[model samples]
Target chain A: MTTAGINIHTGKAMPLNQANVDTDQIIPKQFLTAVTKSGYGKHLFHDWRYLDQHEQVPNPDFVFNKTEHQGASVLLTRENFGCGSSREHAPWSLDDYGFKVVIGTSFADIFYGNCINNQLLPVQLTSSQMDQLFALVESDASAQITVNLQDQTVKVKDLNFGFEIAEQHKTNLLKGLDAIGQTLELDDKITAFENNLPQWQKA
Target chain B: MATTLYDKIWQAHIIDAKKTSETGEEGLIYIDRHLIHEVTTPQAFAGLDEKGRKVRCPERTFATMDHSISTRSLALDACGPTNKLQLQTLADNCKKHGIELFPVGHQKQGIVHVMGPELGLIQPGMTVVCGDSHTATHGAFGALAFGIGTSQVEHVFATQTLKQSKAKSMQVQVNGSLPIGITAKDIILAIIGKIGHAGATGYVIEYSGEAISALSMEERMTVCNMSIEAGAKAGLIAPDQTTFDYLEGREYAPKGDNWTQAVAYWNSLKSDKDATFDTVIQLNAADITPQVTWGTNPGQVIGVNQPVPSPNDFSDPIDKDSANKALKYMDLAPGQKLSELSVNNVFIGSCTNGRIEDMRAAAAIAKHGKVAPGVTAIVVPGSVSVKAQAEAEQLDKIFIEAGFEWRLPGCSMCLGMNDDILTQGDRCASTSNRNFEGRQGRGSRTHLVSPAMAAAAALAGHFADVRDYQ
Candidate 1:
């Protein structure tokens, strides 16, 4: 079984309310040169958060620079998160940057799959549910919620909401199985099919 | 259940069901219409040579030079070092193997995805395979088209088939009326946003519904072109009057009585009214807006008025962290509106959004306004005919007067295969797919958007909504 990282138990949810969070914004194109996924975290928003070339720096008004949510782990966004190009690096950067769970009204199809496959939990909440979570985050910056993969429930205070996950995908994520590993789980069936092919062709 | 387009096309191309060599697995399905290009063909061809095998059916295979040829109108001889060898090699390989090759300067030379349908090689009721993901563009013609790797390319060359598993079918029906300014680009972007980019993976998307049916053949093609971006095998709208009209009297299309027979069969290449799909997604056409990519991938996008998402707004640490990172690279405030963002250059071309219609759309905007100062802008058509048509209508002159460079077509700045590229620290609003860092060139920043949006951005010298101008 895959061991859980830092649990993003949050009853408080701040809604980004924006649509279409593209991959380039998640991990800027500048950081894609490295062969490995290492060291990309530092540069993830280098230009966005700070101005290195200019004498003036740190636009304190930026959401990432705000004090209330500094070091906040869980992220909640509006509809259509991760919509743009299909660079696998987008998810890789997200996984490496200490995000354990992402709750949104919806996500771009490829990014959602990549996030799920890479062991990052991307929860699709109803728009109303997202609004509620946003309200919680706005009221209490330190609000805590529980996302229990075992129960497939997202807990916020007295409310526990069910989230659907494909059975196979759930199993693979819990077990830290990549596509190859998951494909290997059906090895026996594959072998059986192979064995039957040539003989069946003759028939 | 009634037969779907998927059922009809898949049935027509099934050559054999044979067991695998390694495990004698259940017989895998074979395919026809194998397509190759410079990006993935060299190694496969080399592998074949090493194995001492001749191309099994060179006639069935076709090659083209788009990924590595200069789109500059200055002639093919002037192509830079990077593409010269690859371009030459494509011609040499096609000559040696007796496969049809569309080298630079040939009327057929264009994006492999564009040329396939234009040449009628990708027809109804056939299985088409290419080494590029965008090959799914061919599926618009009722063909089963998808991308494959080099090894798979070699397999098709050797045996004209591939080992494959069937995919579940998904139908995305978009009904209702599209707004006047809305184009196929907007429809696709809106779909990706609605369904998420990977929503269609492991499935072929059959686009139906009222809006799709009303679209022109070219419009349908624009929608199918990006099916791969959504992680689908392909996308298609059922062939109809538009298809018949476009194919009539074309070079490769069937003629006279043969055309009648073909149309009769083509009419049958649709999902039956009562047919079912594994999943059905219904969308309203009026809800979509012109889309733009703010991040590296096609899925990371926003409407013209939306603000960039900030990480603090997320409950998941990864999403927060990733958003923070994206905000950094894009050099924008997460909470800031997209309209306020500035653009350095505007590029209107590529397999995704480059076409005669695309050029015309950009020209429509350019005709009314001059490109904003300091905004470097260009409009590269998809083919020679497209360029000629643009010139015939004086679209090129209109673009030129508006300070947009009009150039020959060859995947310019789409994937940086040739000399067309963005310099370090240059930010461009592009009409191409993919904004992977340096995808256009080293240290280049690309924001993907619709052609109309690109034109608007050029006029504003920044990211702005076309609706404002409209």
Candidate 2:
């Protein structure tokens, strides 16, 4: 599997501070009508980010609407981010919105899978670690936080936090490899197994 | 070692399995049936086109247009431009890839989950996958069926395999017979209430015991269909004579010598007596009544006779917080009687409850009287075949005569994908799965119920207990 390698990322972290943030909140169903994946950034968090139906006015109360978080690329949130609905568009919207990393206490299974497949990294940190990162980011919005996938560490000035991820996923991301590409490499084995199947079982 | 039904099926479909380098987890299980829908497959087909790859096994794959099409009419051109484009893209993609597609106006067209088993394409011991989460509905046949992302969809299209980590096993046993009015939807809702929304996370549940075995094939599908709502990866029941009977003569089912051989294999798909699960839970069917969701999540449910629960009733902070938010979104007060809540709309369809049996249950109630003057009720058959069956029995006439719209087969109000939707602040008694805020429409309040309960609510213009109608 080959992927756009991401050994290190340094960016401002935006704090969402919500739990069980579902995919609908990430990207509303109405915005999912687009045929391609590229144009979803503008509609990310449609209901929360916008105050009116036309989406011409931004909701100032929203985290993303604040001036300080304009160019933020890392999202920090509480547990169970991206729950409900297995739409891969959630990650597509996030990735299109320029978020390279989403750090949360936990994530829904399918959303985590989708993020991994889409080249957006979802980092699971302990609750205390999440609190530390949030506190650090909040204390100084200008503080640049760095995530090093090579060392499995998240560093914010004096504080450094360690995280764990599956080796295969880590390798896939680092190599810019698509999952289907990796699976295709095992074609010889797959074809061999298909050949050995009974006549009735062959598709 | 005694094997579970999940393990047996998982083992049977293994083309290549190995522990991943990071977590040492099993990976790469082959899929037997890959079902596709327009809503989630467009991106996947685009991925295939980008790679210039063909569908690995066209015979094992099936495509349909459901989520983005209008269920109000059979005319394919009647859908809005966005939905029309999605349907056209799906049809074109299927034509390009040699995949079998049941497009709008086709007799086989319906929700992907519903059409799979209805066509007898989902058999016991097969590994089934689809881009939509409700694909778990096929697990009722004892298959390892689960929803997948578009990336996985493309992977399955490319290799007919998925890299998966083994899920923990959970066994839920409903040991007693249910009362007359309580249907499979009620039982599943009751279970979800007991086990909160995240109770079955990372687990594949196997529902067993007398109650499960007693349910008809359609009822079992209803149970498995909502497994994802409870956060389960998949849900399964051991294949039995009822399962075989349901599949025996269907369109894609085996025939003659193959039928006999298939049944013999399905018989061996059940779990061994000594097989152990990670968790075991038991519920008495007698303790359950007709259920309805009082909050935004399916897990926030209560019996029809019960009052709405206050956030104060929950000790956990997370539960209390979520309950408060749900109540605010749903515009409900504590201590309110669920049966007294008025509904402006009643939808008795979706992949969950759009089967022929579900239509029959609703027809029985609508036949008794007309829909209440202020209510807008719609009954959508799961598939064109189911619609044909309902028309043959004149069930559509019963519904139409009662002022309920008899519509074409598609996933309508279930997710607000089409024209069938509730206006803002409108409360609906819906038979579809998921009561999430805005699931049906913006600011729409959904109370999940069975078809009979939805019909009863339609007639009464409020949440009416089906038992009273019975």
Q: CA lDDT, every prediction?
A: 0.69, 0.88
Model 1: per-residue Cα lDDT at residue B24: 26
Instruction: Estimate TM-scores for all models.
Output: 0.70, 0.96
Worst 10 residues of 2 chain B by lDDT: B18-27
Best by DockQ: 2
Q: For model 1, how does the per-residue alpha-carbon lDDT over A68-142 read when each residue is reduced to its tens digit? A: 876666678776677554444565565565556888877755566557555778888787777777777777777
lDDT of 2: 0.88
Screening candidate 2 with a backbone cut-off below 3 angstroms (N, C-alpha, C), the clashing residue pairs are: A1-A177, A2-A176, A2-A177, A3-A175, A3-A176, A3-A177, A4-A176
Q: On residues B252-341, what C-alpha lDDT tens digit does candidate 2 reach at each position?
A: 988888888888888999889999998998999999999999998889999999999999999976678889989999999999997778
Could you give the fnat of all candidates in order? 0.05, 0.48
Every model's DockQ: 0.06, 0.64
lDDT, candidate 1, equals: 0.69
Using alpha carbons, what is the TM-score of model 2?
0.96
